[model samples]
Target chain A: MNTILRYIFLNLFVRLIVNIILGVNVRNRDRLPEVGPAIIIANHNSHLDAMVLITILKQKAMKIVRPVAAMDYFLKNPLLSWFSQKIIRIIPLRRDVKFVKEDMFSDCYDSLKKNEILIFFPEGSRGEPEKISVFKSGISRISEKFPNVPIIPVFMHGLGKALPKGEAILVPFFCDVFVGNSFQWTGDRGSFMDMLGTRMAALEQEGSYL
Target chain B: MPFNIIVCLMGLFVMLSIASTVVFVLKKIKPQKDYKELSHRVKSWWIMIIIFSLAMILSKKVSILFFGFLSFLALKEYLSMIPTRRADHRVLFWAYLSILIQYYWVYSGWYGMFLIFIPLYVFLLLPLRMVLIGQTQGFLNAAGTLHWGLMTTVYSISHVSFFLVMPKIGGLVAGNGGWVLYLVFLTQFNDVAQYITGKTFGKHKIIPKVSPNKTYEGFFGGVIVTCVLAYLIAPILTPLSPIHSIIAGLIISTAGFIGDVVISALKRDLGLKDSGAMLPGHGGILDRIDSLTYTAPLFFHFVRYLYY
Candidate 1:
């Protein structure tokens, strides 16, 4: 019942915000995975990043798509925690090592085993708006475990300005979402991170006019 | 609601039906060619026409509100495309807010405030707001760009809605709806006419630096076509005589061409193609309404001077 309600609400809310309120230009959207057990890595700036990503996918495919968010932020209050977990369907990960006991990747791995598509923002937290920061190694560690799963790199522009960190009001702005080709696991951590970084940088350049 | 508007809309539907048939036939003839973009454009036109007709037929208030929404979209597109300083976000908020106030003047029929609110009041006040922000590095550029955007997108476009509140003059056959329809239809028609004629017979480039596809052949061809249509439709839709209608067409064509190339120059300066991807194959709200930006204000004042 919760899943059905969440899907229905998100379908309407996201479509209204994305299609009617904002002008979103998506390129190479076909690169998104059709089935599950895949990792979609994108640069994070605004909270709208995940919403925009969710809005762009096919409706059926969107049901299996789950965004990995930090527990400290999204699960702060009781109401927010319930809303984030039930409505947004985020896989909450502990950001603070002091509070975490078991392995953090356990829930992520379990979801992947269930054939769910996971969205990872490798930049541990939202950095300066519109600027890409160095990605943390959480994504590489997870990708190593699921070597066969494809990783799709996406770079989005203008969302940061639309509803950036610390800004609640969403200014209607034209946004661009560029989806790059999917790749599998590289040899080691450094090389895999380098490959992902290069792919994301190249995707960012694709949207740049100047 | 008026009989004249109903007749004009019927004519428009017939014209669109013919266009759809031609596009369908062309696609069947050239199976290998990519008509995806062209088809998308025609499909968008259908949607736009339906929305526009609904707004016009619903009520005067709805028509004004619809144009106000258009102004909002156009301003948002302009703000999104240009580079701005972070300190100017608050000023940008005010810029967006001005659209509501500008359109309110139209809704209330306050001609005095409608004419000078943006030019005299918002113009002076925006710089003051920027000064309060106190980030003086790119101050001049920021002020100039923001004000110019307001003038073009909000102030100029608001004149379109002002047509709704305009008092009907003597000898006018159709209602104010006809005036609005006439201006919008002619502006868009001129754009298509220039594009088609330019593609077919264009050889010498008119302005290679600004817009490469524009040519003298396209310019004169669009003018002649638009003028003839204006002469025919003016009697049915507007109060203009044949000679005045021809002059109105001349103004729209020339100003429409200028508006198109001017926007092209801005995009060239910004190193971008298309303002934004709001409409498939049509670019952005700004791109779709570029000619309207010039035609709306010019035609509004032109008609006001002659009739109202």
Candidate 2:
């Protein structure tokens, strides 16, 4: 009950303030899967990008959708750890896999088994804002195990300029988050990731996402 | 503050209420695309009017800030739509700074400084800023787009508030807000008149390449109706005599029409259907006030030349 209330408060109020300040323009919101599990992948730029993706989702979808963020960063402090665990519903992943825990992958699989959606920034970390780094293979590597978990590529623009990685103050500027169509994993990681990258970049050149 | 001008404003409110009711009824009856658009516009207008009137009623300072805030939004939309190269990032910062400086010039009523701030100083600073940045790629395009955005949004919009501070020109209420209301009412009413006339009697397209829906029929109908509306309202709302009111009406209608088309040209070049999605039916702040951009400067200087 508390989590539901917190989700509603964050989505309705907290996100509203951020979205307003950022002037977040989320297009193709209906492209989100209404029910069941899917991995939402986007080009990471600023910390705000993950929050933007979560804010853009429908309340119904947001309930089941979990953003896959870095454990070291989000769990660094007790407050962030508590908020990520309780309110925002973040799934932290261990980036340093020298001590790989099988439980991390299984936890994601278990979330999917519960028919919950997972949001992943395939770029792995926040790259230079406004520049889409070549996507890492974390998403594709995880997707191989669940072939049917569709991948939705979302392209975000103007976020780096709005609130860059190190900037403390947010300059209220236009930010467009364009949600592309879903693609089923074809078991070929390289080609699928290439196709995803192309589709995401194309939104910047055209007005179709708007 | 006068009884007659207050009545005139009340009449406008009544007319808007009637229009909103009609659109609401139409939506209930059939909910067609056109009616939906009209209803959305009506709803937005109510919000715009309420906020504008509140600011105006509060004081001249609030009204100036209100218009400044509007220009700020319009500038944001303009800057966002264009591709201001990263090299011009600092130059763009200077350009955005013009919003504050120019609006302050208007609010402070620094007539001499406001006249040359953007056109002269900002123009000089823009190229110099880019040169210092040392990035030569698309230099001309970047500078030109930023200059044009400032010229149209900030310089043109400041003229609206210049009406507020203009020295008394023997009229009903001087420049307290009479002329400001007159200019806005005419230009905006011209827009609605043209759209309605075009939809009803449009046959021959007027420069369909620039704006497809503008028609010869709409063009004439809007001018004639807006002229009459201006003639009736100008005396109560502005200092213009019967003859000058007629002239002001004609100037506003024709100029407003051109302004709307000019923005249409810009958007067409940008390959955008609308400037932005800020307003549901209206498109963007820039779209909403395109006519005002032309009418405000033209009327401000016209009034200033003769009176201020």
lDDT of each: 0.88, 0.80
Residue A175 accuracy (lDDT) in model 1: 87
**Can you tell me which runs of candidate 1 are displaced by over 4 Å?**
A97-102, B32-34
Q: Across the candidates, what are chain A's individual TM-scores?
A: 0.96, 0.89
Q: Encode model 1's per-residue lDDT on A128-155: one tens digit a residue.
A: 8899999988788888999999999999
- Where model 2 places Cα greater than 4 Å from the true spot, the runs are A1-20, A30-39, A57-66, A70-118, A128-131, A144-152, A161-172, A180-210, B1-6, B24-34, B168-170
- What DockQ does predicted model 1 obtain? 0.57
True contacts kept of each: 0.54, 0.17
Worst 10-residue lDDT window, candidate 1 chain B: B84-93
Q: How well is each residue in B1-308 modelled by candidate 1, as lDDT tens digits? A: 88888888778788888888888999999989998888878877887888888898899999998998998888888888999776776788888889889999999999999999999999999999999979999999999999988888888889888988998777668888888999989999999899899989998899999998899999988999999988999998898988999999999999999888888888888888888877788887888898888888999999999887
TM-score of chain B of 2: 0.96
